[model samples]
Target: MPTVSDFVIRRIREWGVSRVFGFPGDGIGEFDGALGKAQRDEDGLDYVRPTHEEICALMATAHAKFTGEVGVCIATSSPGGFHMLNGLYDAKMDNQPVVAIVGQQGLNALGTSNQQASHLERTFSDVAVYVQTVLSPEQAQAVVDTAFRTARIKLGPAVIILPHDVQGMEFSPLTPENWVSRSSAVAPSTAICPPEDDIKRAASIINAGKKVTFLVGHGANGATDEVLEAAKKAGAGIITALRGKQVVPADVPFHSQQLGLLGSLPSYNQMKDCDTLVMLGTNYPYGQFLPKSGQARAIQVDLKPEQMGLRYPTELNLWGDVKTTLDALIPHLEAKTDLAWQDKVANEMVEWENEMEAQATLTFDDGVNPRRVFFELNKRLPATAIVTADAGTTADWYGHHIRLQRGMLGDLSGRLATMLAAMPYATSAKFAHSERPVICTIGDGAFQMLGMNELITVKKYMKQWQNPQLIIVVLHNNDLEQVSWEMRTEDANPVWSTSQDVESIDYAGWAELLGFTGIRVRTDDEVPAAWDRAFATQGVTLIDAYTSRNVPPLPPHITLEFAENTGEALLKHDPHTVEVIKDTAKAVVTEGVERVKGKLHIGDDDKRES
Candidate 1:
């Protein structure tokens, strides 16, 4: 008879799970054994072991994000489960469907202070939509089914705990009885649309306004055509949340790139100036960047009703799938002839792009400008490339400089947890789409935290990819750049060198040791060629670009509070204060010059060629 562990593996495969990310331990030894047996039996499931449980979990989340499949991760009891929390939270907060199969102490050992035992259900309660422990072999299938179902429906992580002994038990199917519930692997359709009345009401609100702005998030992904059509008809400018970057390409005329701190100036201005706000598939968290309450009438469309009005005071809420809802609502919208607002927003976007180039090319004495690295990569990025970024100044440069063309995909930890999911995300993305090239941008602090370990995971699996063009770009700034800026701007305090400074590491040297091509970049001129060599290399490559720590990751719109707080911190005579001030002044001056040139049409003939 097949063991319960065997049945669990077979069932997930039947549910279309071809890959599982995990780290093995004695607690899951039986399952690991079963995995080996399945592999011998030519089972299609590919089990991948990362260096740590946290990385495995992050890989699972990335798999779901990249492939649009339910990502599954497995880990042992206690410490293994604890390590999976951060990645699980990343999935939960970002609303990705992930199922975590964790080991637990045997039923007999429960509450007995057994070694490696933990109350996993209680621990996972906050991050998972469903948490269940299978007590018997007959219960395993149903639990697995329910876990996957809940994860898919809720769009979050789900947990299934299997006691050590349960894995060894003889598999038994649930009987047709009232107490023993049986479930199928088939997922229900999610094509939903709002009622006709609600659609008309939303249309009326949008039709009433002179200046309309559409704020889109990750949920609007597949509805790009509908969104663009609706925006064109309504003469509205589109602004994306970072997660929604791929939904509408930045090259689109009326699409303002991104919103909030990592967003663009045109997006910030559009939100503040619009008379009407239409939110689609995104619950963008930064309310301050949005129109003030009562300043603009809002209409929100979300698959989840609960997420609709939480961020903004909306006059109308449409509970439906983004594509379907927009498809239904588009016909009801009246076409706008006067596109002055749209034209204005588009022109601002052109100016913003010019300013971005100026910022990227700004000279820094300490190291190469980080923005220049991303700006160069942006020019070289293939349309099919999948990009991942870690949380830090790396994300800032990525957000401002990297423009996703059609067919390209990109994402990070949307909640910005700073656990450094970029490496794992890129790893899983390459696994999901073996034929596509992948790129990851990370800061030194995050790279030191967990990215280095994940590189080994990449080294182990590089040959498995059809296209082994994985580029890991490390922003080798010898400082915890983002946090230092936050301390200065948010806390009005000087840099705490002891806590913020990061020890330098030869990331490229480390990659070379792992049998991967490594390029060390220290100057602006070397940045473009480094990208070129990485892209040209047929195997995995790492670009260790030394960037200036003093170069500020300026926001789209600098407010009074931010300016004042930064001024206060500088007044305290922080270490590197002179460098910070000089870098900042240069950036601001560049922006001003770019703006003047844009307005006067002075530099159009002399624009830098790509």
Candidate 2:
């Protein structure tokens, strides 16, 4: 008779799980033994040990993000299982396919206040799409099968709570009918498409507008060429949600970069002024940035029917595969000839590009500008580089300054906005597509959050790297700069303890000790040279850069209240730099207005009704 743990591990492999990331602990020895047996047999899943269980879960989520396959991770009972929640929530929010197998204390220990005791099924319920506890060997096979299927089909985290004693019990072998199947029952297809009449109505709305714009998201991944074709036929200017940043080529004539706070001025202009907005496969949450009621007639296309018009009021909603729906709608659209809207969007795009270049090159005489780091990295980025940015000030630079070229992949936090995900995401990207160079940008505060221990995971797998250029660029500003700025702008408070006056950590020394080539950069001129050295290194490298904490991540659309609060906070803390802050704010606003004034007819009517 086979042990329940052996059956579970074999079932996981049958479901095409090649690797499992986890941290080893007590009460899970039987499961570990099963994994060990699989490895020895040369037909089982490979076990990857990370320094922490949270990092393990994050690596699994990122694996699914990059590979479009279900990611697998495991953890021991109680505290170890609880540590996996943050990463599992990231997967849940980002809609990635991940399955976490948590070892609970012995079945006999239930409700007895035993050591490492936990009600894991209840604890994992909210974070998982499907949660189940295997109470006996009779239920192990069905429970494990359901966990894998639910993860891939629902595109979120699923959990299997395995008890220590249950996993050790002898079990009967599974028959052929109990084996895993490759095909999914819940994937997108034409059968899930909306009614023909709804698609026709959407096409009519699009055809009626003279100035239409397309807002796309990650759901349009496989429909790039079709989307471009539809945009050209409809004469629509294109803008993307952050997740869809690289889904369409940014260099296209009608493309206007991303929208919302971490976006470009041209994108804001297009979304606000268009007569019709064609939303494709994106549930962009910033309703304030989108066109208000009666401003633009909206049409939405999405695979999920419930999400079709939840973000914005829709005149017509088409629910289907983006590629298939676009194929049907294009034939019904009238070929557009008006270049007025296109020219207006194009002019703003040029100005935005020029403004970005100016901002990226602006450096203080004293400290390194973090924007310049992104500029230099963009210049050195390979066409196939996979870039990931942690949530913080570094994300601001990565989102705005970095230009993802063709064949490049940009990994963001999406809805989670969690810190310390960048390095793990990049590490998984390296393993999933080892031929591509992987770069992760993280702030010093974010680096210390959960990323410090994960460097060992990178070093552990460095021998298998195909690119030999796994670079982790640390923006060593020694402050929680983003949170500090938010405290001032959002709450009208001083920087407070967020910007602690602590001594800098020796990040470069730590990296060097972990078998990585570490380079510390304090000057702007060393930025590009440091990147050159990192790419030339044989394995993992960390470029720890000391940047200024005073430079703020300026918003594309500045409000009077924000400016006022920021100025007041500056006066309270650093009175000497008030004028500098004012100048920076004014320069960005003035440049943006001048760029789009000609197209928007800003001064054509001096009839000031107010």
Candidate 3:
């Protein structure tokens, strides 16, 4: 009879999981044996070793995000499993399909408080959609199947806890049908279209409003064309949540930028101006950005019925996939010939672009500004590049400035809101799509937190990468800029411990020591050349640029609270408080003026030309 480990590994491979990310340990010797034989025979799953189990979990999460396949990661007993929690939460929060297999202490050691023992099931309960421990060899197959199936179907993490003793136990005979299956563990799931009456009701609601805006999300991933069709018919402008940024091209005539605090003025303007908000495939949680209840009629479409109207009160809640709903609802919509609303919003976007360009050009004499650095990177980035951003001011800059082309794939921690994921996410993207350039943007503080160590993992696997252009852009501000900005701008508190005064490490030097082409830039003149050098280099490269920490991440719209907080924080903290606030306030006021002019028909192009 085959060992339980043999059956577990075999079933994982059978479930269409070609690779597993994790580290080997003494407690998982039986599983390691099975993995070793599988690798030797080239008939089992490929095991990828990362420097840390958290990195392994992050890599698995990213793999699932990119491929829509069930990503798997393995860990040893106790501490190893504990390390996976952060990454597992990243997957769970992002709603990516991932399965974590953790080795538990021997079953005989139960209640003995053995070394490396913890309640694995209890530990994973909150993060996993399915969590169970295999008590015996006979239970291995069912546990593995349920974990994979649940992960894929639920689009979240599942955990399987295997004790050391159970792993070594004799199992039932391994038949082909018992271990291997042709279908994907999650396949045979059908697309759910909304009922005809509900679709018609949604169409009716959308048609009734003269000015409408369509908010798209990640659920609209593959239905871009249909979304555009619906938008055209309904005569609506399009705005996307951060995850749905790629659903519609930013350069399109009616497509506005993202919404919320990190969003653009045009998106906010469109949302406020629209009479009806037709939300598709997204339960974007920022209700403040959305029209309040009774402020606008709403039509929400989601594959999961429970998500419908959870964020906003919907007049018509259509339960369906994005593409199917759009296809069914299109014929019912009245094509609006008077596209004045969309055209006006489009003109505002052009003005916003002009403002962005002007802001990107402003910089201090000490170092290159973060905006210009990102602007230059955006210019040089390949159209087919895969971009990942760490959670910080770096992501805020990227969100505002970087406009991804149709072929590009860009992502940040949308809901996880965590740091140290960018490097692993970019690495996974590079590994999955080796022909595309992979770029990870991170702040200096976040880079020091976890990204610096993960560079070694990139170096180790650099030879296997076909693209040869794995680039890491470090915004070296030497502080936790986002946190500090929030404390000052949101809470009106003087920045105290939020700011870091650590001696700056030569990030590029570290990259060079790790067998990567490293370049550090401080001037505007050196910016483009550094990016060019990184892109042209034959292996992994790091471009570290010292950016200004004082440059405020100005919101598209400055409310009274934001303005007051900025003034209060500056007066209380910095010596040059007035000058700092005045300088930043100039840009904010100018953008605000343009929005007013657009609303009042003062400076619009058509009005001016007339």
Native-to-model Cα distance after best TM-score fit, residue 362 in candidate 2, in Å: 0.7
For each candidate in the order shown, give its overall lDDT on alpha carbons.
0.89, 0.81, 0.81
Candidate 3 TM-score, true structure as reference: 0.93
- The residue-by-residue lDDT of candidate 1 on 40-82, one tens digit each, is 8898379899999999899999999888899999999989999
Better of 2 and 3 by lDDT: 3
User: How do the residues 1-610 of candidate 3 rate in per-residue lDDT, one tens digit apiece?
Assistant: 6789888888887788888898877667778888898789888886778789998899999998777788899999888999999999998877788999898889988668989987888889999999999887666777788888888767789999988888889987535565443333344463678788888888888888888999998878778899989898888999988888777876687787788888887888787778999998887988988986787899888766777888888888887778888888899999989999888778878877777777777766545778888888888878898889989788888888888778788887778878888988888888788889998999888788778988987877777877778899999867777887787788987666435443589999999898788898988788889988888887788998998776778877666677678678877865435545655765555555555554633324233322
User: What 10-residue stretch in candidate 2 is worst by lDDT?
Assistant: 601-610
Please list the residue runs of candidate 2 whose C-alpha ends up more than 4 Å from where it truly belongs after superposition: 173-191, 498-503, 574-610
Candidate 3: misplaced stretches above 4 Å? 173-186, 497-499, 574-586, 589-610
Q: Which residue pairs show collisions in model 1? A: none
Clash count, candidate 2: 0
Ranking by lDDT: 1, 3, 2
Name the top lDDT candidate: 1
TM-score of every candidate? 0.97, 0.92, 0.93
Candidate closest to the true structure, highest TM-score: 1
Any idea what lDDT model 3 has? 0.81
RMSD of each: 3.7, 3.4, 3.9
